[model samples]
Target chain A: MADQPTPFERFIQGILPENPVYRQLLGLCSTLAVTNGLKPALTMAGAVMFVLFSANVIISLIRNLLKPHLRIVVFTLTIAAFVTIVDRFLAAYMYQMSKALGPYIPLIIVNCIIICRCEVCASRQSVLTAAADAVGQSIGFGLALCSIAVVREILGTGMLAGFRVLPASWPSWTIMVLPPGAFLTFGLLLGLVNWIDAVRSRKKL
Target chain B: MEQQQPDRRMRLRSGFKNSNLAQAWLVLLLALVFGSALAAVQVNLGHVIEANKVNETLEKIPELVFGADAARKLKQRQVPIEITPGTIAVEKDGRKAYYKLFRVTRDGTPAGWVIKARGQGYADVIELLIGLDDRAQTITGIFVLEQKETPGLGNNIGTARWRSQFVAKSTDRPLVVVKGGAKRPDAIDAVTGATISSRSVTRIVNRTIEDLRGRLIPAKIEFSERHG
Candidate 1:
C-alpha cells in the first residue's frame, strides 16, 4: 500500500473496482434526468468530468492540512466552485443547451460522485491518483448515461441522436419521452447491471 | 475520575488543534477563492449571456410569424405591454404582436405588440397574435401562436389554408368559425377534423379585438395626430 500505484492500476481501479455509476451507484440523479436524450447526456458527462477532475486535484493537494470535521464542507465548496464555472460557461456559449438542462446543471454541486472521490481518493492520496480516480469515475458515469439515452431515443422517438432510425411506417411511442419512461428504463438498466455482476461473481467463484 | 477527565481533555484538545482547526481553515480558504472566481466569471459573462437570449428571441419571433420582414418592421415600433400572467403585447411600427407570458421581457415590455386575441378552441387556451395597422387598428395580419387541442387535427391554426380566412376580414365585427366555409364577410372555414382549433382561433381573435378596442382606439388617435 505504501508503494506508489502504476498508471494501469489507477485506470483499472476507476473502471472496475471503483466504478462510480455502476459499481458504486454514486451519481444516479443526473444520470437519469439528463440521459433522456443523447446530446444532453453527453454534455452532462463532459461537465461532470471537468468538475470531478479539477476538484480531485485541488482537494488532494491540500488533503493533509484539512481538518477531519470540516472536510465534507471543504469538498462541497470546491465542487460547487467548479460547477458554477461550468454552468456559467454553458449559459454564455450554449444558451439553448443550458436552458434545456435548467436546474440540473446547478444540481451537479451535490452529486455524490464528486464529493465521494474528494473524500475517498483525493483526501488521502496524491494528486495524480486523485486525477486518475476522477477520470475513471467520469468515464463510468458517461457510459451509464449514454446507455440509458440510447434506449430512450431509440424507443421514444424512433430516432437516434435526433435522426430517424426506425422505418417511416413505425409508430412512435410518446410515452418514452415522458416521466414514466425514465423510471422504467432506469429500473430495468439497474436490474440488468446487477444481474451481470452476479453472473460474473458466480463464474469467478 | 480527575485523572480520567484530564486525559479526555488532552485528547479533545489535540484533536481540535491538529485536525479540526486545520480543516476549518482549509475549507474557508478554498471557499473564498472559489466564490471570488465564480463572481468574477459571472460578471464577465453576464452581458454576453443576456445578449444571446435577446438574439435568440429575435430570431424565433419572425419564424413564428411566418415573415421575417414583417416581424422586423413590427420590432421597430413595438412597445411592450403586459396583458396577463404569461402574456405580452408588442406594439411596433404601427403593428401589434401578442405572445404568451413565457416570452415576456424582464422589464414588463411586450415582446412586440402584434394583436391580442383569445377564444374557445378544441380543448383549452387558444391565443392569437394579429399584426395591426398602427394608425387604424386595422388587422394587417394574424398568426396563431398557441393551442392545446389535438395534434394533426386541431394544431392547424398555424397552417396557411385556415389562416387565409382572416386575410380580408374586417376588424369591425368579431370573426367566427363556421361549420363549412364562412358565408359572412369576415368568416374563415373551420378545419374538417379540427373544428375546435378553428373555432378557438376565431374566438381568440374576436375576443382580443374586443379587449383591445379601448386601448387600440386611443392609441390610433394619438399616433395619427403625431404623424399628421
Candidate 2:
C-alpha cells in the first residue's frame, strides 16, 4: 500500500490533483447550474464551503458515536440544517443574488460533495484532516466553476463580469450560456486535464 | 451479583445498549438537537428576509412609475417623494381580490400608484410591480419582481427591453400579445420562443388595469375636488 497521506496532502490533493469537480466529478449539479455567470458560481462556492466544512467537522466529532447503519441519516440531517442557514442568510443579506440563484442554493442540501466527504474522509479522519479536506475540495470546485463561467460569460454575452471584454463586433455565442455549454466546457476541460496528467506521468517514468 | 439487584430500569440500561432500539434513540436525540438549531436560525434570519422582500419593492417604486429616466433624475435630488402603502380590494363575480399598493407623493401631491401583483407564468408564478399614471388611465412602467421562467428563453420577460413594451399602454382596452404575426395598435411583441411567459405577463397587467382603472380615477377625482 502507498504511504499514508497526511492532512496537508489531503488538502492539496483536493485542490487540483483530486479536484472535486474536475477529477472526482462530485457536485456537478451545482457546477453546471451556476457556472453561467461568475457571480453565481463564486456565490455557490462560498455556500458550498460553509456547508461542507461545517458538516465535516460535526460528522468527525460524532464519528465514534455514529452507528454504521444510521450514519447516512445523521449526515443528511446535519447537512440540511447547514444548507437552510445558508439559504436564509443569502435571502436576508443578498436578496438579488438569492433571487437569481433561487432553488439552486437550497438544492445544495443534496449536493454529493458534502455527503461523499462525510462518508469517505470525515467518518474516520481527525477533525483537522476533515476540515482541511473540505476546504481544499471546495476551493477546487470553485476553480472549476469559475473557469467554466469565465469562458461561458465571455462567449455568451461578449462580456466578463458584466463588462464587455470581447470586441463589440464579436457575435455572442448564445449557446455557451445554456446547459449544453456547461457540458461542452466540462468535457473539453476534463480532456485537457487528462492530457497534462498523462504527459507529466510519462516524464516521471 | 449485587446483594440487592437494582430495578428492571437499571438492568434495561445495559440491555438497551445491545438492543436495536439504541440506534432509534440516538436518531431521536440527534433530531431534537438539529431541529432546535434550525429553529434558531429561522427565527434569527426570518425578519431580515421579510424586510429584504419589502425593500426591493420600495426601492423600485420610482423607476416603476415615473419611467427609468425620470426616476434617475428624481433620485439625483435624493428621492423627494414619500411612498405610503394602502390596500385596494376589487370584487369581481362574487370574488374579492385585495391589492397592496403604494401612493408615491412628492411634497403634498400624489405622483403615481404602484401595485403588487402575481400571476402564473410558464414555470412558476411571476410577481410584478406595476405603475400607473396619475389618473390611472395608462401604464407608466412595470418591473418584474420575481419569476422562475425557463432560463435564456422565458426569462426574457424580465429584461428591460421586453418590459418596456408594457410602458405607455392605455388602460382603456386590454393589451394583446402578438408573436410576429401582426403589429396592431395594442399588440405587444411576445418574446421569441417565450410566448407563454409573455402572455402571462400581459394577462397580469391587463387584469390589474381592468380592475383598478375606474376605482383609482374616482379616488383621484375626490382628492382634486378637495384641492380645487
Candidate 3:
C-alpha cells in the first residue's frame, strides 16, 4: 500500500501532478465543448465540483459495505444521484446558463473524473482525504478549463465575460470561436505544459 | 472446467454458484435505495423546474408578437391562454398539433396575438414566436425561440438584424426568401450563407400565418360584430 499523502499534498496533487484535464486527460469532452466561452466553462466546472465533492463524501462513508462484484454499480448510482441533483438545481435556478450548457450537464454522469476518484481515493481513504482529493482535482480541472477559455474568448470575440477587452479596431479571429480554434488552442497549451515539464526535469538533473 | 447444474433453485442459494446470489441481492438493495433517492429529489423539485420552463418561453411572447412600442405598452396587461387546435380550427390530425397563444390587451381591449410556430430547418427544428396585428392582416414582428442551425452560418437566423426585418412585414402574400436586394414587399433577404435556414423560417411563418388566419379572421369578425 502507498503511504497516505498529507492533506496539503493531496490537494496540490490534483492541480499539478495528476490534473484531471491536463495531466490525466479525463473529462475531455466537456473541456473541449464548453471552453469556447468563460461563463459556460466556469459554470460547468462549478457543477463538476459539486458532483465530485458530494459523490466522494458519500462513497467514502459507504466504502466498507461495498461488495467486490457490486462495486461498479454502487459507484455509478452514487455519482448519478449527485449529478441529478445538480442538474435539477441548475435548470430551476439558472435557467439561461443551464440552456447554454444543454446536454453537457447531463453528460456529467459519464465525466470519468468523479467515478475515477470514487474508485481510487474514496473507496479506500477517509472521508476527509477523499474530500481533499475531490477539491484538488476540481481546482485542477477548473484551471485547465479557464486557461483555455481565456485564450479562446479573448481571441474569438475580443471580449472577456461580455466586456470588450480589445480595441474595436482590432480584428477578432473568427476561427477562434469555432471548433477548430478549440483544437488548436488545446494542442498548443498541452505542448507548452509538456515542454515546461521537460525543462524542469533537466534543471533537476 | 467444473460441471455445474443450471437450476433456478440452486442459483438462489447463497453460495451455490460462488456467491452470485449474494452479489445480485446486494446490487438490488443498492439500486432500490439510490433510485428512490433520485425519485424523491425529482418530486420535490418538479414544480420549480416546470415553472422555469414556462417562464423561459412566456417571457419571449410579448416581444415577438407586438412591435416594440405596443409590446411594452401591453406587457402590463399580458394574459396567457392555452388553446387546443380543435377549438380554433378543423384539423386533419387533431392529436398531432397544439398551439399556445398570448392575448395582449390595452385598456381592456384586445390589442394583438402572439402564436408559436415550428418547422424543420437546415440542421434541426426551427421554433419561432410570430406576432399578428389585431386585424390579422399583417405580421407585427417575429422572434426565433430556438434553433440548432450550423453555427457561424445557419445560426445567423437569430441575429437581431435578421429578426428586425420581420417587423411590420405584410402577411398579404406568403413570405418569400430572396438572395439579395429583397425589392419585393413580401420577400425577405436570406442570410448570406444560410439560405436554407432563412427559407425554413419564412416557410414556417407563412404556413403558421395561413393556418392561424383561417381560424382568427372569422373569430375577429364575430367578436367585433357582437361588441361594436
Instruction: List model 3 lDDT by residue over B53-111, tens digit each.
Output: 76766666556655666557655565432211112433534444455566555455656
Best by DockQ: 2
lDDT of 2 at A151: 90
**Sequence-dependent TM-score of model 3:** 0.85
Clashing pairs in 3: B65-B131
C-alpha lDDT values of all predictions: 0.71, 0.86, 0.80
Off by over 4 Å in 1: A1-7, A201-205, B1-23, B64-210, B213-228
Ranking by lDDT: 2, 3, 1
Error of 2 at A137 (Å): 0.9
- Most accurate candidate by lDDT: 2
Runs of candidate 3 with Cα error greater than 4 angstroms are A169-172, B1-29, B73-87, B90-100, B179-184, B217-228
Residue B103 alpha-carbon offset, candidate 3, angstroms? 3.7
- TM-scores for all candidates: the values are 0.69, 0.84, 0.85
* Candidate 2, A131-156: lDDT as tens digits: 99999888998899999999988888
lDDT (C-alpha) at residue A49 in model 2: 96
Pitting candidate 2 against candidate 3, the one with the higher lDDT is: 2
Residue-level lDDT tens digits of model 1 in B52-149: 86555344443333344544665575733222223445575678765442222313533333544566677777766665443324555566645656
Taking the tens digit of each residue's C-alpha lDDT, what string does model 1 give over A136-160? Answer: 8788888888888889877876888
